[model samples]
Target: MIYFVYQILPHNCRSVRSILCSSLFLQKKGKKGAKAVEEEPVQVDAKDRIDFDSAKQKLQAVVDRFAKYANDAKLGKTSPKVFDNLMVQTDHGDQPYTSLAQTSIKGRNFIMTVYDPANIQRIINSVLGSGLNLNPVVDPSNKLTLKMPLPPITTELKNESVKELKNVYEKLRNGASLGKNHTLSSIRADARHKLTKNKKLDNLETEVWNEYEKLHKIYVSKLSEMIKAAETAIMK
Candidate 1:
């Protein structure tokens, strides 16, 4: 006689009938008689489960990194370092703004001393298109010098800054979400591979998803609050 056995599968696992198989089968008689079939039960290891605490710790690390960046961005201050990595389009191609000119602060204004007089127009174009909202004009006496005045915070500038902040927030949020989803998928796949039972594996997945959602909300809300505070600081 043949006997079929089936094992419960977790969510995203194979169909119920997929694991159904004949545990006992008749053996063909050779010259004497038929041989008896033997059956053995499959056992699942209790230790194979999701490491949720480790996953949570990794997610927290990402949040901490972004938290510091958000904190540094809270205050609206003009500094020469702001232009450290500013890329400018040049005849040779894109290049760092600092490499093309020297930046110095005169009170609230930025004085740019270009290396070459011929590249004055190019530098001015870079600043105007830099999305920094600063207007650069050539000094009357010195053609090689550009004077950029830091305009007092206005409604228009504040709005621009907030828009930029939102862009940054979206990127960070999306990146974290992708990482979380990838990790969850890996967990689900491993459970399925081990043929874990439905109840236990499903429960573990639910808990992991809840934890990820909680962390996502916390970080997202924190970033939003920081952006709003930055907008307020710009208006002050």
Candidate 2:
């Protein structure tokens, strides 16, 4: 048996009809005891030709069904084995079962193993809490990768440290402003007040520096965790 494969395109119905009609000529033989007659090409009528429109509709239906199956597989709504069976059924047993098995396996792996929605949402929440912007990059193979902006807390802490440092410098520079200069004893008291202010400012600056370092370490650790999660999710 011969199988004829026809690819139909939009606005090419007339061309398809012509090609089909021209290729379907019927030959006639002479009487059994007599010599064979010369062959003549016969014209096939449009009504006698295969109904391409009906075939196109059937093929389109199959395509739509396959797409639905693929989507279901991706969403974890269908098992790989079930999806493979459906594909084979859609092709009316024409396609080999093993030919589509690998595709189904990949689809299952991507949906069930690689991109776990719950895990992804957890990662998203962590990123958001860290005040970082999450950016996803999808490659040509439909695999997802992530990019994140530096955590806002890091910048905020650094800015706060700079502001505290400036305040401490200003206070030290204007030590005399902390005391009144009314008399010698008052001037001595002013000196004592300046000393106390200087010590307070020094402690405040040290605290700000320590807080900045702690925040920087936290930002680095959270970013590393997010990167590891993204790699695990998309690099199967």
- Candidates in order: C-alpha RMSD to true structure: 16.0, 39.3
Model 2 lowest lDDT segment of ten: 21-30
lDDT for 25 in candidate 2 is 33
Residue 11 error, candidate 1, Å:
74
The TM-score measured for candidate 1 stands at: 0.48
lDDT of 2 at 153: 29
Q: Each candidate's TM vs. the true structure?
A: 0.48, 0.18
What's the count of clashing pairs in each model shown?
0, 0
lDDT of 2 at 56: 36
User: How far does residue 33 in candidate 2 sit from its true spot (Å)?
Assistant: 9.4
Candidate 2 TM-score, true structure as reference: 0.18
